[model samples]
Target chain A: MRAHAQLIFWAVLVAALALLPPVVGVLHEPFYVELVRRVMIFAIAAASLNLILGYGGLVSFGHAAYLGIGGYAVGILSFYGMNSGWLQWPVAIGASALVALAIGAVSIRASGMYFIMITLAFTQMLYYLGISIEEFGGDDGMRIKTRSQFSGLIDLADPVASYYLVLVLMFGTIYLVHRIARSRFGMVLRAAKSNEARSRAIGFSPYSYRLCAFTIAGALCGLAGALLANHTAYITPDFMHWTRSGEIMFMVILGGVASSAGPLLGALVLLVFETLLAGWTEHWQVILGPLLVLSVIFFRTGLAGIIPGAGDE
Target chain B: MPPLTLVFEQLLNGVQFGVMLFLMAAGLTLVFGIMNFVNLAHGSFYMIGAYLTLAAVQWSGNYIAGVVLGLAGTLLVGMLVEVVALRTLYARDHLDHVLATFGLILFFNELVAIIWGRTLLDFPRPEWLRGHVEIFAGSRYPFYRAVVILVGLAVGAGLWYVVTRTRLGMLIRAGASNRTMIAALGVNVRLLYTVVFGFGCALAGLAGLMAGPIYAVLPGMGEMILIQVFVVIVIGGLGSIRGAFVGALLVGIVDTLGRAFLRPLLATMISPTAADSAGPALASMLIYLLMALVLAVRPEGLFPSRGR
Candidate 1:
């Protein structure tokens, strides 16, 4: 009975989202599509974060570094006059994966607060480096004159097309994360998160599992960054800022960590709230601050847990 | 060139910067130590302090009065944040603390933007601190800088005295050691936590007020210094007051000197063009390298708490 209810909820959610474009068309609202696209991008970022933070229990305060690297991959390649999708995407993902490996090599040795600080420091180093690079426009950021072309396979210049592409990626990522979470490797990672010593006792090397998870998460976030750079046709140091990383964590928590769909829901809710509240008042954060505090204080289970079918899963 | 004057000036700057960092790290380490809370919003208090000082100075037309009022204002806000927001987080996990404080940072940054326009506000040093003082032959340093150094020293001495020499200090230390025992002794742990939080905020505010004339007063100013303070606390060992003091000094000196001399030093070893390109990048990373080295050698930091 619970499984059936869960199935029904997911079907309803998908149907509702599919019907959104037409509903907005009826209301003469053109910005709704863009908002959805933005939400999808953040959802991807949040999902990547969830792999390490929610599942692996690695509170990396520097996830934005991957995003920045990914974005810069696209930005720098384009600046050097490379506009091929195949080349840019691979380079972006590869660069971010490499960075994750380097940072994770040293940082994964430390647990808890030390891990958090080390991640933060490494990301800040990247942030400052980005700012010091005069060729990349330094603090001002660089403008991508055009999106990466995929040789007639993908036309990213069209917003609707781009939006659909992002949605597909987001869906694929969600499905992939769900599958990974149920796998043997995922079991090891989860065990490590719950108790490292016990996992070690059980003959699992927690470090390698975590590093792999962290690397994979970084690669995924890097993909999101590439998409984001294309979406905006620009990249800046702000892309990798620690605060941006914090926001991704916020989305994960708001939606309920350790759940497949939570990050997506959290991203949507947060983006919508930000848009609505900003429209209503200049001091939207005043409202957000207390709301967040209350959420942490009272709603430890998060919004996903409030859903009748999703609670305690 | 007189070596004594150069050494003296650098030492003074190092001490001053160190003290400011200590003020920032003290609050952070205490919160982390006592409540096991990772409050990233601590920097926001420093930013608020600077903003409040700007407002008060403009309103009251007295810099000294503005500083005092700013400190009080930030303290109030800090206590209110602890009671209204951070209080509930004590029972929660570290992830929750990170999320809540992150939200607070975003909220505060936006609030400051709305209250004060995004443009940088000009903070004028008062007339009394505008002159230069000759500390040695052929060298003159800004009196304001000296004042800052003196103020930092005075505050450090005061903090040491309060923490080591008073009943409240004993309570604070005791709270860090064992919160349940302190509470079991019939002490109001809640009030103590609030006071400690408030006191930490005031120290951040004091740093901000002092920094107003030295640095640009703008939105998101807290961010630049926030990570440095984290490094200080980490190097000093989390939750140790002496650790914070020494770590702050070490970081300040390393960072300041690295920025000032790295390029020149590198030029001798590498090509000038390479040195020019790598100088700032490497300078920025010096403290982080120091942190990693410290972690590698002494993971508990130089002056970590004696026991778990």
Candidate 2:
């Protein structure tokens, strides 16, 4: 039954995507393609967060800082006339990883609110730094004149091509996370989340495993940030703001933590709600706030948590 | 031009800023320490306080009345939030608290924007407190700012007295130390929590009310101070009242002085252009850098919870 469900899920996903473009073409409404692309981008970020929050039991309030780092990587490099994919991608990932490692080292030692506060402070530091960089446009932000070039393979300047590229990366990330979750390393992570003392008794340092998970999550979110900069063709200090981090965490909760595909569903619900509600009224957040409160009250498992056969193994 | 006068002026500014931060941080620490709830929406209460103060001042035709109404309004809202949303989250994890409070932040910001409009509101200092008073032979400070410092010090003393000398304060301290034990003692834990929450809200509201005249009464003003408040609580030592007071003063002084003096100091050492470039950026981060240093040396904070 599980196998059948998986097969059906994959089939539906493929069929929907394959038919979506043509359907939109028939209707002469292709804007949703861009929306779907956005959903995918946010999903990548949410999923990365899930790896730490859900499996590793680390709730970081500052995950969006990595997204900012990733975006800044692209923006700063491009500003300096180094727009090659090889140079840009590695530098972005490396910078994000270094930050994650340093922050995670000190932060992982503190549990609960202390950890949350530390992460928040570090992220705010980044936000202020971003604002202070007068050359990078400070609070105003920097506009990318052109997207990264990938030596004759990917033309990121083309919207459709960039959308497909993001989609591919999204799929690749999902697959990688899935494999890691099912592996021995993932077993220790889950164990640590469930019972740190027991995991310690088993001779696994929970801190190291958690740190590894956090770094990996940061790297993935950074990649999403890079894609996001490409998507908007602009990067701002707002990307790294604490509020952005809150929004991503909202996505994680709305989708149901610990469940695969939860973040994607949550991102879709939030973005679509945001778009539709904003269209209806300028005070869309008022509606959203109460709705979110109700959702948390009623659906502890989130939107994905309600679906049949959606529980995590 | 005298160093003594310069130092005195900076000290006064530091104390004023510190008191404001204490108003914000005190509530945050109390809620977290007593209830074990990590409320990201505490800042929203501060925002509400500012907005309410603005409205109250307009309606009452007096700034003092506005201040009272603002405090009362925030207390009411805080209690309502506790009874409605936060009570359910008590049994849940910190993640739930973080997310729900985040939702509240979004909700409150939008609600304020809807009611007050997007443009920033001017919270006028009362005519009585508008002028400056001379503190030293040559230096003068705003009378309103002096009032803020005095009020903050008074509140801090009152808070200290209540926490240390009163029955409710004993209950709060006890609750923080051990909720289960306190619950077992037949105290109405829920009611206690609500009262504590309301008290914290009132403190935040007071901060907001006082801040209105000094800072722009805007939709997201609370957000700017929220992180700084967090840093103060962290440095003071989570769940420690004495820590919050000391921490607030430390952070406020360091931040204000850093911004005021770092550029000049750097200019004296380095080239003017370099100092000009690096000064503001470094000034902005000085408090956070101090926090990181504090956390590094003392992971639990300057004054951690006793026993565990």
Candidate 3:
């Protein structure tokens, strides 16, 4: 019964998010529409990270690399005068998938802290590469002259349309992730996460499962990245920095690791805190830093843990 | 103008950079080896050291006094942090340690920015250390760099002696090799952790002081160098000082030499424009490439500690 209430609570929250832009429009808070859009984009990113980080128990410190790759896909394509969303979005997803596959191939061989450092190094490599691409505006980054042209099917140029598109995609991603997590493959991944030896003894090789998850996560985040570039109409190497990865990781942990929908809550809370806190003080991280520390030290289950019996299992 | 002279001078520069890395990596490795704790905020200590040194220098009107006070301050601060924040994290998972320390890093970066402002602080080379010295074949080496290398080597030698000879060093090695065994022997492991952490902070501070004259003393400086330090520790072999020394020197030389020479070499082979972009890009990636190669060949590092 409590589980049903928790589920209803989550449904209500997601519904409120869906209704947010209209509500904000009524309040003349156009700024919040942009903020909510940003939150939804990152919600996709964080949820993608959850597949590998929370479910697979792989702490990939270079997840931001996918964001950069995806964003750059759109940015670079648009720079070359191609703005077709159909073309750019898939390219972003494909490029990120390939990179994730390659990085995962090597990184998966190493476990524990080595895996963390290796993933970070790979992202730094990409970051430096981004800076060296003089043709693409290099370290300064590039502005999108126009949003990804959808050939007038939906007109992404319309803010309301773009907002609803992002909102819908985010909902789809969360639903898809929930289904995957309950599937047989996700169970194997979870099994691998808890005890690799036991899983191996049972003849389910965790390696391929993990690699598949990593690739999917990367592709999803890449999609988010493409949206992000359109949403902001700019892309920079700064997007791929390891600290951004840290922020995403913080969202996963802050909301509740290994729990479906936790990353959404995490993303929502973090974005709200950042926006509200930064408005008050330039040294907002001074407050944020301690909050993260205190949370880790005290609330091992994250924000979701606050829900009675939610992550108690 | 002579290629030989350029190589010779750049080699010395590499060694200087290597020495600086060793100071940072040694402390990092020692803490990791002895405590099995990952401290992402180690770089924050490096930043603190540099800022404190700069502040002290400005206040005291004397470089030597500033160095002394800064080192002392960093040591004290490191111990205080360990006692206050890190001790609670000892029993937690590695992820928890990473998250908490990362938080510490954010806190320190913000605090420093608030206190000192975000702009880079000017750290001028002292008068006696400003000029270049004539070396092999009349090649010129900066006096400051040469001094840095000398001091680094001296410290490395001292660390070697202490680790291989002293009772405290013996305890540290023992702790790394087997923590429970040492605790079983009734050693005050907690106090030892504090001492080791403090010593590591001092070494990081020393590196910061040396680095201040070369790089801007500013917020987030520690983070910039911390990646390289992590590379050093990983390449060297966690919990092994010898590994850190070799790894630091190798990374230092390779990085400097690659940046200095790779572009020119590439230009000779490929088209100038191709070389122009590819050279610096590849050069920047050299250390990470080297690390990848090492990990691929030996995941435990070049010299992982024994009997873990």
Candidate 4:
């Protein structure tokens, strides 16, 4: 597909998501709103990860650390009686960015197996830290008493409104990532990923660019974490489990990696597949596991690769 | 100050923990270093090892026999996995290895859960191995745990001898540094890979079975200890057995000692309430902080393999 076609595909996706709530309402299937809302939140996370994993070539197996940080930022603040989105959400993003900065700065010094192991080890560190803290529900986690308040700007308590809010944010996240992929900075990031020594030789130090990209991805994922806390009305250290990070990376890969439409499609397909399988049987993962193996073996290009504008669109 | 006996006892406990971690990490890092293949499903071998031991024990009604059968079963499973799923993956990138093995983890976890029932099972030790032994003036440690340490050290020594003195170890060393040269010299790289992977599985199996008698055999139990083993491998340097041994001991002792002493130490330096909370939190994160500092200072690790 041409660039224009790709743009249209994204535009159509957002438009359809924008209009999904009313259709569900007419069909008396209000449950679909929550389902899609959950998908959007995950989609945001997957897309952010793609920025680093796909575009930046930093295989951060610890992305869930941001999710936990973002979530706990909300959960802890709420525990202290701050329900304002303005205060809660920004802190979530900022905290995750800072943590990401610290983690990335240390891990990025090494590449390949060292990098993967370091990222994973660091996340486990946070997981243990989360479990040790006694306040704000510790391992059992705590409930969010209320949704983020906007002072009469828009009521998030309404499912439709919450759905729309997630939809807007998801769409914006995907678009922002797409823009980043095409920019000079994104080029440097991609260049560094493909050939770091070459990029460095050509007067571009890939370190700062990679770190910047990593931080941006972390900050974006933090927002998704905050949204998730609101959506679930609960927060737990389990959010940062390596398995969750794997699932997000799976979505990025399952969708066309490093593409605009890949994560949205991938998240939708995976969640829906999981939902249907879950409804069918309790041991659905038994089937899902082999299917993932087959996909990795066969779907070399991912679901997005099957479409036009497959490579880095 | 903490009691001398208590500290001495904890030190022994830490060494025992390190011994078990060494068994698991040595093989994992060996395979990782030699084949350049990342096998995240190594934990599955551990799980399968525990489960198989349980099944074989119930069927044979003999503890030693069950352990032998369990190790054999785990080794066979490892060989099969390498030949069937992992052989083709050698040509692919690391990401593919990771993802495919991850899928295998899901499959194996579910498979174990399905076959064995999704509940914890008790692994009974032999009659003589059930009691405690006095190792010091005022303390006695669990006999089985002490056995675990002894058995672990003996195997470690055996492994060291084989890898350093034996012809097979030479080939392994040769294979790690230069696969193409070995393959060109008529060595079957494929067979070597399977052998190495099977060895890893057997070692992991041993760790699992020994651990079963100590902790209840349960699904997903391997994952909990696997990360710590990973920390051992990273700190010890990837694919280095000596590194694994040193790394495991360092992590186990540091972790055990930190959890034991951090609270009292923190109380002396800070407020009691702050120490109470911060101590455990920092103790848990200590290994990771150590890892980060290590990686930051030496990316190739403390014992980087010679000649790449």
The best candidate in terms of DockQ? 4
Model 4 pairs whose backbones collide: A1-A309
Model 4 per-residue lDDT tens digits across residues A201-264? 9999888898899999999999999999999989999999888887888999999778877888
- Candidate 2 per-residue lDDT, tens place, A175-285, comes to 677778778999999999999999999799998988998999999998999999988899999999998898888888888887776787788788887889999998988
Q: Candidate 2: lDDT over CA atoms?
A: 0.87
Per-residue alpha-carbon lDDT of candidate 3 for residues A202-270, written as tens digits (9 for 90 to 100): 999988999999999999999999999999899999989878988998999998998777888899899
Candidate 2 chain A, poorest ten consecutive residues by summed lDDT: A304-313
Q: Least accurate stretch of 10 residues (summed lDDT) in model 4 chain B?
A: B299-308
Candidate 1 ranges beyond 4 A from true positions: A15-28, A308-313, B1-11
Q: Which of the two candidates, 1 or 3, achieves a greater DockQ against the reference?
A: 3
**CAPRI class of candidate 3:** medium
Compose the digit string of candidate 1's lDDT tens values, residues A204-266: 999899999999999999999999999889999999899888778888888888887888889
In terms of TM-score, how similar is model 1 to the real structure? 0.94
Across all models, the iRMS values in order are 1.8, 1.1, 1.2, 1.2
Instruction: Evaluate every candidate with DockQ and list the scores.
Output: 0.55, 0.74, 0.68, 0.75
lDDT of 1 by residue, B145-179 (tens): 88888888788889889889999989988888889
What's the C-alpha lDDT at position A56 in model 3? 93
For model 2, the chain A TM-score is 0.96
Among all candidates shown, the one with the greatest lDDT = 3
For candidate 1, give the lDDT: 0.87
Worst 10 residues of 1 chain A by lDDT: A304-313
